[model samples]
Target: MITQSGPSPDGYDPRADRDLPPASGRGDPHRVPEHFPGVSHHEPIGLRRRLALNRMGTFDWDLDRGFMDLDPGALEVFDLRPDEYDGAPMSLVCRVPPEEGIRLDAALSQALQAGTSSYGAYFRVRCRDGTPRWTHSQGRILHDADGLPYRIIGIVREASGELADSALLHSLQKERQRQTVMVQQVTVALSRALSVADVTRVLTGIGGARRFGADGLLLGLTAGGRFEVIAVAGMGGDVPEEMLTSQLDDTLPLSEAAVSRRPSFLGSRGELLARYPRLRPYGEVLPTGSSSFLPLIAQDTVIGALGLFTTEPAVQSTEARNLALALAGVVAQSLQRATLFDQERELATGLQATMLPRRLPEICGGEVTVRYHPASVGRDIGGDWYDVIALPQGRTGLVVGDVQGHDTHAAAVMGQLRIALRAYAAEGHSPETVLVRASRFLAELDTERFATCTYVQADLKSGALQVARAGHLGPLVRDGARHVDWPEVRGGLPLGLADAFGHDHFPETQLFLEPGSTLLLCTDGLVEQPGRDISAGIDALSAAFGAGPEKLEELADRLSAHLWAEPGSEDDMALLLLHRPAGSGAATTPRLRLHVHQADPSGTAEVRSALRRTLDQWRAGEVTHDVEVAASELIANALTHTESGALVSVELLPDTPRRIRLEVEDRSSSWPRRRSPGETATSGRGLLLVEALADRWGAEPRGSGKALWCEFVVPEMPEASARVR
Candidate 1:
């Protein structure tokens, strides 16, 4: 029975209304009202009654004039009285929410731009009681002879019942789908958690609130009859200290859920405060609306509880409840697994630490520091180790090694190997000999394990470094000027494999560490990261070392702190640092030590080269020729008379008249005796030559051996003698 002024492209014809009864006079049933100029009032009296009964109202809008007229029925649909609205379209805006009004405007504009003949839309209208009601509007565009839109005629009606019958079912289905997706995403994230820290990070990190569709999330664990808060996300205000830890029997909601192993739901914060009045102090900081607390259970054990909060009233449907419970189950499993991994890792790390030296030995003229860090991700211990052994002749031996594999067995092997290496080094064996014996010992063990090691024999008094490696990284040296470099050291096969491969020789490299310099030796773990080239890590380490603090302790701490910034490293690491301080003025004499094997023909030539180099550095080149001749004769006599190799030392004496002192030590007890012989006798002329070329000479008993010594006068260097750059 709804009427329109003109023919509606939406099937409403104005001609049909002409068949109704004629008007008697003013106020007749068949006459249109003056207020509703857009409505065709020629309808029958029964049609008007039927239209009013159905609660359908008609509207006419003049686009050109920017005005609209609503019938009495349309005013009823908007919950407005006849006297409340004007004839303008904007007069009805008070009934529609801002968001709904924007949507309706957009729809109308689209239809006008598209030149559509008709359009329909549904929107929410705010009632007088401040509740939103569903309403539908249908309009047909009317055009003039020029094909331009001049007016619009349509009808408006209440749609609450219609929406209740169809839209409700669709809303329920969408909510179910959302819940399922939440569960799947949470499960997938938890699967990668390997520790308690990892699990909490995944739950409380970015985007956590949106994934769970909650305004707040709180997670806790039960320990020693107390509940400990682990993570909190999306909560407002500061949390009290007492709330972070509470007894299991406390009246707190999370504690109750954990102890009872059940789920509790509260429709609002008011209900929570009413049920548990003890929570009143925390009410201001807690989330509003509804909240749910579910116990985290795994294998029939309650380990903790999880709390979820929303800002709106909860539906309390079966699917929502099930989703919460499923999420709780997934988290419980991950937490339990992570806890076990932590316990095992703790035990393994303790065992690994026990295998290392309890304390580094204090050495004169040098400061030493060591650090051992376990792998950050696994349950098994690694084989990295560090040791400092005090050797004879005021020297120190620095060792860093890693045994193959990560287990208790690896730790045991490392302990035995460390002891053996320490004993061999302390017995005055050379770096090459120490590693060969260590490899032989490991090969003899019943287990099939190998190790990589870098050993440095440091002569602090002489500033001499002899380095040897067995399939390991070479040591790094930082000079007094903060320049860092990695000296080349040749390597052999790894221990236990050296004997199997029939290669037991590890060649030694000689380096000079000036006073105030530092030597660094570490396992590869310190410079190795998964998927990255090792050279990059090495370069980074070198840069950090060059920029570190001057003090040994502070530098060691700074390097250790870098480990916290890098993640996902599966290997353990060991570090050793030795610093040689620059002593007072000329009192610190420059010295050099070179070892000469009994049968090594090249040993003499290498010693001569080292002598030239040391003399050039000290600006004592005036006596180089005499010192070289005397040293050669002494070395030949020792190699000829001693049953073992010799240790040669050359030092610049700091006295009124500076002198260069040379000492050749051998294992033979027989001392050198000056003897006169025939002119052509070659063997007897060695000592004669030493005695004639040196300004002074002597012999002394040095530990199970004899040290033949010589000295030569060296004039003060001229300023012009400095080497050209």
Candidate 2:
């Protein structure tokens, strides 16, 4: 057998006959090839009953799998001959009971799936002495690329004596006492072990750390409810060095017990083998002793499972098993809390997304595209929010705000402030008045938090925009010639800090559509970077917009991609953009004979209705009927499915001598895929219709979301192009 290059565990002595990794494949020349000196040494019960498995068993299974010959008398115990043995299957040499095989198979499968090193179970096998011996068989699985298991080696020891001996139970009753001492030792030593690496080394029995087994100890929570392992004194392999670091979570078996609030027995290795029958091929895969699974229950909850595992067929005495369970319990409690916290965070994220607008409103005067990209990091849902509020007074309320915290509580406050902004705005209040009331609403939020916001109310008639900023980033405006930034209202504080602070009236700033101008409103995530000036981010945005409508989409995508980091950024982001055709001048003073005003909302729903209204007013019959629903669905979809902090714009390209074109702009670069016909899964299918209806339709990234556009030729009016511009 081929042994590894590393030195064997302490006290292991190697000789020329010892098998190493890449063994010669020839049968081992040493008599009774085992981890010991010779057959005679292991034969005498009083001489060397311990397998010296802890000292380092056959290290090179690749070189050879040694099956030492038992005395001829021992072979008579089972009806087997040496000639019948095959290296491919140890089962061919050992007689394992049917139940034992099934049990062990199941265990191996669980171990492999869970990324655990060891899996063991108790089972009965036909012994060479014509006796049925119950034993625990445990194996360690080695994996390679593609996650396939290459080899599994296990140890088996007779457990029948322990199962039947009442006297042995008494002797083992004090196991828990030892476990208690170990827990105290591990806790006090915990401060000394800082990093994950340190923790790993300590778990491996270094620095006075307790050892459940001198051989292969799985230092994890017992499934029943304890922080311990199945103690095997004379076993095999170095105290595993990777278990601490390899674990995804510390709870393990304790979580199981905590959930059930009951003690658990490790399923038999025979059961494990039975479930993973293929593992049987690795060794005379059978059970050695019954194992126990303890749940680590904490605060009335199961955080993980702890396993007292072994390769012995007979169940250990209740006392020993309980000791294992108890030790595992302590470790489990801490791990469970951590896992529960992570779950809560995920739930918070879901709720935050739901709170944001799922769909944007549809407008007819011009096409408006919107995209929102959320930040890549944070513990829970963030405090950023955006809204499309259609006021009763003909103006559209575009608002975006950021609460001061990044948790579920922050999210709740955001929702409250959001509705209040709309309620006051819908009640005929101007953007400045709405901000004043919204500030008051936030001040009573029950928590000391601040909120910053930018509110804009765009009037369609004069193409005039009213903007109010409350301690938020300046607005970016691109008016044909160059990009311009609107400064803050001078003296304003983040909301909720003081009553008088919110009482200050925000000065409203108004600017005309300014011919080919574009307005960009976004959260600070768009401009803030650690150790970098805000101008750097602002410069990036300006440069992309300055490139004009031709490169606008591509540049937007590139910029958005740059914002995401590997370890991720700290805050949630919100970006909203409104672009009017630069030279063509959307909603600008008449310039084209037929001007098609792009009036669509940031979302897909309202955009479609607005598109249909425009087509109907122009008297395009089937053209309007055919794509009304399609346009609505596609445009609404553009609002969702991608990052929320996206730059979205829409354009109305009048077919100069013929048709009117409708274009939606966004930064998402992924090609829209079609799901199975009529998938109700809430994300696909919209793109399918866009492909079929529009003339020469395709997508390119806008500032953030990808623009999905289509063209429709109108025939009725000779001046149709003239009517659109």
- Which digits, one per residue and each the tens of the lDDT, describe model 1 over residues 1-725? 23456666555564443332212222221223333223466843544334444555677787877778776667767777767887877888899864455446545654664577877777767877677667889998987777779888888877766777686646744764576577667867888889999999988888775576678889999999999999898787767888999999749989998887767778888887888888898888888778888788777688999998888766565445556666777788999999998888888888888788887788978788988888877788878899999999889999999999988888999999999999999999999999999999999997899999999998887677888899999988887778777755667899889999999988786676778889999888888989988998899889989899999998988876684238756788898999888861224566677778898887887788768766765567668988988889889988887788878888888786889999999999987777888868667787788888899999999887889999988887666643231
| 532: Cα error in model 1, Å | 1.8
Candidate No. with top TM-score: 1
Clashing pairs in 1: none
Query: Cα-based RMSD of the predictions, in order?
Result: 20.1, 24.7
Q: Which regions of candidate 1 are displaced past 4 Å?
A: 1-173, 563-565, 584-725
Candidate-wise lDDT, in order:
0.79, 0.53
Model 2, 270-358: lDDT tens per residue?
66456445435432422344555555555545544544445555655533553454455444443554445456656777788888877
> Candidate 1 at 190: error in angstroms?
1.4
